[model samples]
Target: MAPHTRYTRLAEEALSPAHSVIATSQTYDGAAPFPDFPDDDRPAPARSGGERLQVAVTALIVTLPFLALGLAAWLLWGTLIRPTDALLALALYVITGLGVTVGFHRGLTHGGYRAGRPVRIVLAVAGSMSFQGDVIGWVATHRRHHAFTDRPGDPHSPYRYGTHLRGQLRGLAHSHVGWLFRNDPTPVERYAPDLLADRDIRAVSRAFPALCVLTLALPFALGWAIGGTWLHATTALLWAGLVRIALLHHVTWSVNSLCHVVGRRPFRTRRHDRATNLWPLALLSFGESWHNLHHAEPTSARHGVDRGQIDPSAAVIRLLERLGLVRDVRWPSPDRIATHRT
Candidate 1:
């Protein structure tokens, strides 16, 4: 993490390690360090009235679609999931999933490959559409994750509680989504000094709010043009906009929770990383399921270093490399794979 930007301090302090940092600015907004985790100067700000309203709106957006789908299924014996809706949602999922895995994780956070200006802006904007957070903050939290892994300071480790079933369950919840609401923002300056120096990152960070609206509005417009009706637009908003975002959220969160608790670890990573390969999540997670290898070799472009492990994000990077859109590729080698292989 870079330590250049000065962040604002918060009055109250807590010890929770959160996965998501509050996207207040391109600069790293931090408070004084807590005693629990060293290099833990992250600060989560108090919820403002606008933030509270956004939360309420988000809840409503997620709820109403399910209710409508359920009611239609029960009362009218109708299928709420239309072919177009499914197609749109799937498309959005893949696009935004690549944005997070290929763009945010591999490109920005790990420097698995180097991309040109256009690629960087596109990836950052696409990633922001996933509603994860600003790129700099996301990178900051992720770098912190790599720095700590499953140790005490990890942003969202499933082993934070204990080995017991009760503790595991608590830890899983905390890792999956609980920590997002409960914890404070990470100190970006400490984690992402490189990004702060780039004006490109600052522009993308500032466009976050607009990117969010574009994510939803683009789908709605597509639906309206295709179906030529407000009804189709509504359906698109529900399926492609809200449902896709929520599902991706949980899938990304699952890497923090389920991947840590379940799945097979094929690589010898840092002690106690507990990251694993959940094959079921490979497709949806866009190859992020190869968490063990990711932990073992943080800078490697490809996480699925072995045969038959589908890594879509790596494929994208490979294509971009071929097109000269990305350079300084970090694709894993035979020696690198053997060293990490269990």
Candidate 2:
């Protein structure tokens, strides 16, 4: 029985030993450490006062460059919006935001679908452009979210505090952007072992900072090549770089905050989770606004499973499938949809 039990638990144990192991250790290496398991389960120490202060201060500092650029745009460009700059920013934002939604969240994090080698590479690069942490880190945090949605261990749940208005506001703030400073990052080995095993994903993740620079710099380079001026490049940097990122950031955070707070709940979700579809954010979030369906069917390839729900991400997936770039997509079926539907 012991040997059979061990073999049965091998896969789950490899992923999260704590969940499979039921025993405890008195002490090891001068501290308590479980034996017979090769994983660590201790909660990482929270940030110190100074570290937290530094993060808050740094967040404040980052706003200055964008503010300065905004001021420049007001004084120099006047009220006239440049078509070229707007187009460039629009293109970049769409490409990069899809990378996070279709690539990082759906593909990498949830295994909702599989992409061919070329598609995988392109998605990875696109996600890198979004300037979120590497693929491994993103997957880790996301898997943690699914594992403990709206619960204590979740990385960014809006219900962490309480149900009062002030508490919800505080929780919303934390889930939006404040948690980055306080929450300990999810361990890649435990949550994203598959990604860590892949050399290409690791390489891309390790080079994330460089990719972010390229994300910002490429627009400027394109602008310079087209308009033949440093000023044009600067404008591209502002519209495409700062504004685009700000837009994506707010929308993504809304999925963590607003999705849980407001909108229509048309699908049944686990108790205590209030994910809903906020229609206004649909286009901006690239079809991610079908929050109720998403929480109800996390790995379904399409979140917008009903009428009047626009899902650009699903369209992209369909295009890729038509191009023979993705296979075995776990699209929602009528039976499954009916089962989970409200």
Candidate 3:
């Protein structure tokens, strides 16, 4: 059978009622039970001290880069942004963004391809620098997302509030960033057991904090080296380190929020899975906005399967395949693509 068909069958088996019950029963990091909003539109209950702390940290992570955007703007008004700063921001954005798309999401979460031990570890480390989350947790949460999709068990779904206008507005916020504040945790054991079993991946997951620091420090050091000044270093830190992160964060979150609510769905997915192909976000999101097809064939390495749809992540995977860095890629066949079409 084709890889897409095989993966679809496997995913269905994995998300069977028995497995769903077991997954929902377990908790990761001692998180509290996930709230059931239904269509009532009631406010979420109060959080505990630990949950409050988590929320504060998540808020800082979500907001600080946005604040940097304002600061960068102010700086730009007063002083022109250096070409080096712009270049550094672009470089780091592409690196960290591709790491998440290719490494964390496709390779680790969906088994899109297989790479050598060194390649796997490097990719994991690179993805960790994106500041989304630890590799294990990221993979686990995404796997759970695919399993439950837009249903009650989904960790982040824009349809959580129902199909009403008020609910959609609220649900969009919740799915985009508010879900980070919730205490709901996806169990790594249930969702990403293979990553947990891999010693290299475990190591990379554990080093997430250090990688976060490195991500920022590298830009600052490079800016200082290239421009030979503290001003250059500070500006690069703001633009490349913080602003770049903020942009990538919102772009990634848009796939969870706007893509579901807007855009075209050329492919059929599971019931309630309203993932869409958003053209505007294609370049920024590295083709992840071609989400409808992704949901249709969750394990397909290439998401932008149609004509004139640019998929940089798929291009990178093909490059890696040619370089012999990765193998067993699950590229979708034309027949498979046609089969999933609506």
lDDT of 1 by residue, 1-342 (tens): 221111101000111224334232112112212123334344445788976875666556445544655444463354456778779989998888899999888888877777878898889888998988789988888877766566656678776666677777888888887666543456777677677877998899888878888989988998998889998887887788877887888899999999987889888876556788898999889899988888787778898878899999999999998998988787888986888878
Q: Estimate each model's TM-score.
A: 0.82, 0.83, 0.89
User: What tens-digit string does per-residue lDDT give for candidate 3 at 70-125?
Assistant: 99888888678888889999999999999999988878778788788888788888
For residues 39-94, write the lDDT of model 2, one tens digit per residue: 24565566889768757664753464447466656855546656788899899989
RMSD each, Å: 7.7, 7.6, 5.4
Cα lDDT of candidate 1 equals: 0.74
Worst 10 residues of 3 by lDDT: 24-33
Over all chains combined, what TM-score does candidate 1 have?
0.82
Estimate candidate 3's alpha-carbon lDDT, on a 0 to 1 scale.
0.82
* Model 3 bad stretches (over 4 Å): 1-18, 22-51
Clashing pairs in 1: 1-190, 1-191, 2-189, 2-190, 2-193, 43-185, 44-184, 44-185
Which of 1 and 2 is the better model by TM-score? 2
